[model samples]
Target: MDAGILFWKAFCENGESELIDLTTIEASMTDSVVATLPVINPSTYTKTISSPVVVIKSEYRRYHHALKASNEAMPINLLYGWGLIGYWGGVMFLGTLWKVGQWFYYLRFNKSKAKDIEKPNQSSQGELALPKSLAMLRHWILLYIVIPATIGTYHQRLFWWSNIPNRLDSLIVFGFWALSIILGFAGYDTFSGNPTVTSLPEQNWEMLSDRTAILSYACLCWLWMFSGRNNIFLWATGFSFQSFNIFHRHIARICTIYAIVHSIGYTVEWIVYYPKYFKSLKENWFIFGIVATIALSIMLGFSSVFLRQRSYEVFLVIHIVLALVVIVALFIHTSYFGTQYNGYLWPTVAIWCFDRFLRLVRLVYCNFSVFSGKAKTTNASVMYSSASDVIRIDLQPTASSLKGRPGQFYYLYQPYTLRGWENHPFTLGAFTNGFEDSSPNTPEIVKKKVTTTTTAQLSDSSDDAVKLKSYRSSSLSNTLTFWIRPYDGWTKRLRNECIKGGGVCYPKILIEGPYGHTQMLHTYDSITMIMGGTGIACAVPYVQDFLGKSKIAISYTSKIKLVWTVRQPEFVEEVCANDLSAAICDQRIEFEFYCSKKNVPTNISTSVHSSDEVTKQIIIQSGRAPVASLIAESGTEAKLSNSRAAVLVCGPAAMADEARAAVHQALKNGCRTLDYFEEAYGW
Candidate 1:
């Protein structure tokens, strides 16, 4: 009989009661058919199967190879998932460790120095040698590696590739790109003979598509993780929101790249392999995938640094809307995979929701209070100074726990305006006790008399000065102030409102945060500040903090120097008359004002000499401030005193860069005890 009949006869005898290993039976039949055939007895099953068995064997082997290939790919997909988690977790771990180290150093060394008298030998001690050495190393890394462009200066100094920012950032992004490419093509065990339109094998296209799709989902989690204002990483690491924002933008680009690759791979596969390519595109999963890719592309295109710098509000709205669209579309696209890939998608939604929830909690806690069945709200008084061309806002929040500190900032919202939801971040310039408002019409003679009497009393007796300080310290009302330089958009409108109300206005303001980490400048022996224009806002609070600490006799900062450069002499005079009045005459502090404009008023020139001995220490000049020389002089002073120093710069881009370069050069020239801090909003 034929081999087909023989196999049928064997199947009837087996009666489906015994399930045979067709794969193993088929393999053995290729070598020796009679020995491997399933039979109750050898005498009853004498017929041999031939070509028919070979045909059936080839069919089973095909599917067996496919299943084997799928099993091999599963672990790689899972590895990509865990790799993302590990990278992010490592960053958080490092941040937490750094924070703990900072706290330990403060408690162990600086705290005791603040409370006790320093021994003469303490100044020459090498106790802080390790930390200073580490600081120098970190500066070297930043100057040579992190801050430079990848290939050339054009990208770093020009607006064309501002998105990447620097070499280190680009390298990090390139690492992810390399990872996706490597994993997409490696470890494939099976391939079909058919070739794709791109000339890649059909199985190669399938694996590449699947891998990129899964990797993109993994990256989505971190993209959302870094976008939050209240990211825990900020608190643990002391990194500014701007640093995380750079990470967010880069991760978004990597994610979009993955998505584009995934989309294109499948598109080519369908066009070449499937006859009904357009029909497949009509499917829900395919359409959602396309939607997600397009949304991501649009988000990346519109989120360029150039465009964001030009119109932030418009960019923000587009970013938010497209973000939602991408998330929803991704959810629908991956829904067909059931719960298999939901692990990556759900965490993304949870992270975004958690961030928004924290923001809501902060808003409620900072703005509203309930006492005896009534709610109280925070109000602000805004005044515009035409001389300085800046807005001064004073806010007193009812929330007792909301205390302002150095380096902290808040988002101010004008609830009564058309765009009430709009808000802007400003540094907390100063905070003081709330006092009863005095009449604006108080006579100049009365003011001069009171001021003269107070000055004489302060000058004549230490006891009287102490009593005045005590009286001021005892009144503890939380009044927070912010100085905003008026520009286009919200700030200009705010200026108009102040102008309309005769240079001052009281608007219902909502405070959203006290964000940012504070630097422990008090731990340093000396401090140098390089400020430009309205960057004085960054300097005033720290000066006041050092003075307050000195009053309590618990500060290590023995010397403070401020170098301010402004366009107008009037602004300098205004700041001196208001913000710098208290600290201006302090013996340990020095002030150097450089006005870029040439025409200095005679009255202003004479005002610096009005106090004679008290104001004689302040130097006023016309020209650009010598940023490098100032930094070098401060370093030299610190070196001579054998004390650690901090150099802080907050100013326009060029001024800040000049200061940074100066500090870096100082470090290279053996200024080991110097630490650098920069305060500027990257956005």
Candidate 2:
């Protein structure tokens, strides 16, 4: 018989009964006749064992276990941990560096305190907290938003969030490319490994694990910086939350990519080492990680601008709940698994808590007084107009020192009526010192009475004069005005209430912040304010500001124009009766009111601002706004003045887009340099 048949005969007697060493069998079978003979036919072989046969998984487990303990894996993990720290520290240090740069700009104002800053009462503080000229100052500050995003989008293009305009910069782009190249080589250790040691396979797993942690750490840092009150602090340091918002999607996308990679890496590892993936899933740690990934995916999916615009309150609530769920899932996942990333998650949680605490502190400070109660606190008084469908809220404040300027906004919390627990942001339409409405019909009579009363009471005492002056200043400090056009949710509910209650109701309300730093307006030679309907609120305060100050106070601001488009004639009358009336006496302000709707009302006031420039102050135009023509006129005025024109607009998206187009046209039409300011009340 042949050696092959002899070996086949022996295997049939011993099959599945005992482990046969392949090397020993091969060495014995290699004796001449087996090498010379054809391979044995499968019809000739049969199993002799009574038990079922199974694949032994011991080798796969030993492979991964040995690789983990290998010399190469140890050094790879050490280097990974060190590199992760460097990546995290680098981001934090860059953020700090920009903040420090802004602080240095602030320090430059010490010697000669800017006389032409905020108001006389507000101790001037812009320095570089706000841009002097927008483009030069903003781009440098925008670097913090650009770099991390470049790393993700450079390799792969993600739509809308990926390769969008204004989010990338040259300096940050170069830094990102160079850093990525260095990190890529060092992280993989030049792919050096022995095949027998399984270093290559194990190092692949370790690299993926390390990158997941690094990306996660970075995402948390961004979250801590960009969320609510934390974002406010960063804004104060000259890095606005608006800029940080651009990077939010990019960071989130990158982290998601890392998480997917991590999940796949572990899936492969478990299948190779632990035999059954379902068994690994039984561990709470593995399940939690999977849940976190799912939660993140859902949160990111719902975070589009369209969904937010559709229903911000719902989107906000869901976004927040999902974020909390993700954090909790990640916490449980890392803790039970003994993953080192648990420490990073705590800082994120702490920052979120701090943000909530700070918001609470703001609520208390803005709305209530410790000494008194709700009676002394700033309560919102709602005044609505049925014809215009607008709500004029006059907030009576407790803190007189907390006076805001022309361009700022505050959050309104109206729980009893809005049908939501959150606060809504509104632009500061007008700022009243509280004394304006209460001022006596005649200024001369009021002045005479104050002078007479003080003289008679204290015999012309200097102390009484000083007291009177302080009283006059403090009287005007605490009233804030907001003009809201009812839309949906809170505004719609309020509008219905106003409709039922004869267009006015005073509801108990709480105020939160005066958070904005709307740089300089007085520095410009001419200003053209384009107001779409209720956008008059933003323009009116600036007019009042210009009128109150003299040539000595505002040397640059010679000409001011307000182009207002209102749907109803009643809207113009209501605003003019309140805020616009004050600017009528000032010749520098040339305001026009345009009634856009058909069958224009007879009650529209043709109020003349001056005896000289009677036509300039408040000109009435019918139909839609001639935005392009008005811009061209303003550009001509700026050219005549030999100074840059500032076109400040506050309105609907259509109006804003029109203004932006007109601005481009103005720049083209001999306007030396045009600075555009858009006041959008976006929450």
Candidate 1, position 623, lDDT: 86
How large is the C-alpha RMSD of every model relative to the true structure? Answer: 8.6, 13.0
Candidate maximizing lDDT: 1
Task: Enumerate clash totals for all models, in the order shown.
Answer: 0, 2
List the candidates' TM-scores in order.
0.81, 0.69
Among these predictions, the greatest TM-score belongs to 1
TM-score of 2: 0.69
Candidate 2 C-alpha error for residue 345, in Å: 1.3
Pairs in clash, predicted candidate 2: 433-476, 591-617
Computed on alpha carbons, the lDDT of every model, listed in order, comes to: 0.69, 0.59
RMSD of 2: 13.0
lDDT of model 1 at residue 338?
Answer: 77
- Residue 556 of model 2 has an lDDT of 47
Clash pairs, candidate 1, are none
lDDT of 2 by residue, 549-643 (tens): 43225334677888888786556645554455556555567777777876544223344232233322344567877887888888777667556
